[model samples]
Target: MSDFQPAGDGSGLRVDLLAIADLIEPSSRVLDIGCGDGELLHFLSGSKDVDGRGVELSQAGVNACVSRGLSVVQGDADADLANYPEQAFDYVVLSQTLQATRNPRQVLLELVRIGRRAIVTFPNFGNWRIRWRLMAGGRMPMMGNPGEYWYETPNIHPCTIRDFVVLCRDLGLSIEHQRVLDGAGKAQTVRIGGSWANLFGGQGLFMLRRP
Candidate 1:
């Protein structure tokens, strides 16, 4: 049986974020890159007593996080991450934001360098829904939202789960743990490293560390 648990109902977090929280240890020092409105940081701070900090690109998002009393700064993951020293935090998280980074490889390197471990989550371009839509309609795929057009989407470096795994291997990063999520962002009971998961999983969640 899979150890993945269903995200708590009404946890005031997106299912994916909730799952990420579960992967964290209580009282840890955390840095949430591309934290958006600091939802994960806030939740971790309150529930897990984590000493949470955040970096968000959007000014509005920084404002929102600051208003919520989260220790967040306005910064870009692509460039600003280099300023952090090695092993500065217990965990560094990038959730659903990898595809949007200008240089994902550099950002990922920075993640593992700055934290003992890194937690990453992103929509899987290899999901069957995306593949079907692209093959059938011959247009760029959309993830259940008709309003989001291909050109307008922020995902510039869209990648499949397999691509991510290969990148991690190439970078010499160890996969501490990994899980697949279903359409509702709930963790699924599937072999996350298998082809079946690449075909059916809606998203990929990973815990990574350097060797």
Candidate 2:
């Protein structure tokens, strides 16, 4: 319904969504948190034959996914994840939604508890432009494409790549794979806590599991 193969690239996914799909394997059971319009689920079902389920916060989003024949339900991420059973899924993905949650740490715990592996992605709050904007303007920074006003934006408690790494270490979550994507939306080599990712990377994606 939403154009499954936008560019004939086989996945019909956006830059970020394509990357997230690449991290998933064939025929895996996946639960997508904040799965905006079920684009990823649609793509996965077509390309990977995955068992995909999604939870979205908006009715419109849910409707869109349903129209595409994806299994999706409307729900709040911060509260709903707690109701899912332990290790019920092979993979749980929280793509670019970490910062918007009411309690990221608790949500993170639930992610690992509900799935054997958790894939998380978020915009890097430590991008130099974000830093420069706040420092230069003495106010909360405008962000993302066609950036929104500080007070009106949905993003709350945004964190950096370094900050996320620290939190994962503190929580004892195993980071099986990690990537820092730059402004062009391409992943770059990064070492945990290294200055490059903290200073220049505009986004981060990570795969986690409990040890």
Task: Residues 1-211, candidate 1: write the lDDT tens digits.
Answer: 0123346676667778898999999999999998988889998999999999999999999999999999999998998998899999999999888998899998889999999999999888998888998999998886534567787878889899999999999999999999998766798888988999999988899999999
Residue-wise lDDT of candidate 2 within 1-211, one digit each (tens)? Answer: 0112243455447666677788898999999999989988988899999999999999999999999899999997898998899999999999878888999999999999999999998888898998998899888876543457768777877888888999999999999988887654456676646897788877888999998
Instruction: Name the weakest run of 10 consecutive residues (lDDT summed) in model 1.
Output: 1-10
Error of 1 at 170 (Å): 0.7
Q: Can you tell me which runs of candidate 2 are displaced by over 4 Å?
A: 1-10, 190-192
TM-score of 2: 0.92
Cα RMSD for predicted model 2: 3.3
Against the reference, the lDDT scores of all candidates come to 0.89, 0.84
**Candidate 2, position 66, lDDT:** 97
Q: How does residue 209 of candidate 2 score in lDDT? A: 96
- Angstrom error of the Cα, residue 2, model 2: value is 19
